[model samples]
Target: MPEVWERGADDEFAGRADDGSYDATARVVDARGVDDEQRVEAALRPKRLADFPGQPRVRDQLSLVLEAARRRDAVPDHILLSGPPGLGKTTLAMIVAAELERPIRVTSGPAIQHAGDLAAILSSLAEGEVLFLDEIHRMARPAEEMLYLAMEDFRVDVIVGKGPGATAIPLELPPFTVVGATTRAGLLPAPLRDRFGFTGHLDFYSSDDLAAILVRSARLLGVEALDDGIAEIAGRSRGTPRIANRLLRRVRDWSQVHGRGVVDLEAAHEALALFDVDVRGLDRLDRGVLELLCTRFGGGPVGLSTLAVAVGEEPDTVETVAEPYLVREGFMVRTPRGRAATALAWQHLGLTAPMDAPGAGAPQLPLDGEGRFS
Candidate 1:
């Protein structure tokens, strides 16, 4: 977790010139017409469980758990939501609050540094409040230990003072729910993982679910979309509602510029192609990473650092964006040694598969791919 101190929304992004600070959220900074696209998408994000598409079984299971908790007037058990990015983990956190009719206080792991920092946030929680801790696995070690006791005993032991005079102050915290979301659940300590009442693993959405999400999002955006266009977009969305909404927004842009009245199949296809996304939906950068790994590293049992250097990208970016989908699509595998791009890598990239490949496997989309809406 990166500790980026909170600043005003109107704060200008401190460019790379000053202390090499990079604001990843710069794209969301106040701008003109282009920024509106980003803001509108935020408005389109689902606020309720019923509106959040995909991962239906988890939602149903969660609903029962929350309802049961609310019936007893208790904070619902701590939930751990783990998945790849853009899988609506945050949205589900909000939905949990909405269903329980409780207030939600949102913060990330990096935001809490020292034990005192954790104490500040924990002490302020109202009874039955939902303390949404996004990326909980990335919390600092001291804070994480504090959280363990808080989750386990409904109390936080805060250390006051320093050195020889330091004293532990045990504070009674609210009986609140901790909805922790993480892209890398494996990084969480075993003690932390065990503390959660329910561990929900969010998986990729299927084409049909993605399509339904597209329909819902398009309705929100006031964009008329044909059924074929919806399906095509869904298929190419990389199985994320956020990406589906992004593709739709881009199509709307192209439609306005090309004099197309609404998003039809042709407009959608053209818009995606212009953005360097293919029919099977691998984007240019995605293919770039895989191609380098396959051809340069000879299908790679390559270490992540070596691969990152090969592709001229940060190890984290390679692991996060380019790697997860490739792994899930069976284009890569995470061995004990390193990452190995698979036979599907060759097939997807139009290369010949080796006669005996180690990582050759079928792509079975996870349970989240099953049609929940149907």
Candidate 2:
């Protein structure tokens, strides 16, 4: 008989602080969600893969995997989901379980600090259960190694007692599927990465896809939203469904408080303006980084640490959160030396890029053997 254990709640949405004030500068990569946000996101999430809006490629691929496993009357192969934050990785994990008609156990890498921690979870899983591991790249080394064995062989070797007198006890686990989610797939070791049979990389949502997501979310939230208002919010959603839904809620609040309880283009613009999100989806921290690079640094290559300090943010925050979107939008560039603002960045800030600016001149030489853009 499998032992019962508590399943950790999935963290998805970003929300207000303890003081009830929304944090516009929170790291998009962080998965910790406030209670209100978590509840609302759970309700907003699509229960099955067919209902999932965006990422058509991933949705189709996952459908095949689950359907084949169902026909075979066996657990599906271990699945890996990799991409930037807010791209529905967690939601996909839930959909996998739903499609398979199996119970899911949710936990994160940081929660499993020791091999025993992982062994316990594996031993407790019911046959054909889905174990959803969030942030799999951050799992402890020992735990990760244990996971490699468990994922491949459906067993864990539990070590008892101290180093010298320790005895290895092989614990056979029920056949189950592991669905791992990570924002940094590259950080995963080759051995562990190879254990997963199917890997799906989710891309940022298109504006049209985002608009479609907003329409669904608006209906679900019972917000009376106009088409133009939904389009306005989607355009400023930074290619993320999470941000789109969040912005929609903010617009709803603005409409109720300021307008006549109708989410229109005016309400969206006013709410987004109040929240410091510009027309280009650049937020306060994003614009701060651009402004510092173009004006303070003369648009030259500055070290990432220096650029982050200038913007009053952590290097990881600047790199993982703001930099991806900025570079994707062509407003910034990552050079061999460091970070540089592009001409578009300068233009967006209503400034001109100098001739010798990092991106304005000829291409920069590669650092070492790597490409110009590290």
Model 1, position 345, has a per-residue lDDT of 80
Show model 2 residue runs off by greater than 4 Å.
1-37, 358-374
In TM-score terms, which candidate is top? 2
Count of backbone clashes, every candidate in sequence: 0, 0
lDDT tens digits, residue span 1-374, model 2: 22222222554433545555555545444455586677788988999887899899988998999999999999999999999889899999999989999999999999999887888888889999999999999999999989888888888898889889999999898899999999999999999999999999999887889988888888888888898898899889988888999999999999999998988999999999999999989999999999898888888699999988888899999998899989998888888998888877987899977886645665645542111344
TM-score of each: 0.81, 0.85
Please report the TM-score between candidate 1 and the true structure: 0.81
lDDT of 1 by residue, 1-374 (tens): 34354444666653333565765654444468768766785778787777777798898888888889979888889999999888889989988988888999999998888878888988999998999999898899999998999998989877778899999878998799999999999999999999999989998888889988888888888888899889888888888887888888889888889846588899888999999887667887788888987898888788999988888889999987888777767678898878887786887788976745564554444443332333
List lDDT for all candidates, in order: 0.83, 0.87
Error of 2 at 197 (Å): 1.0
lDDT of 2: 0.87
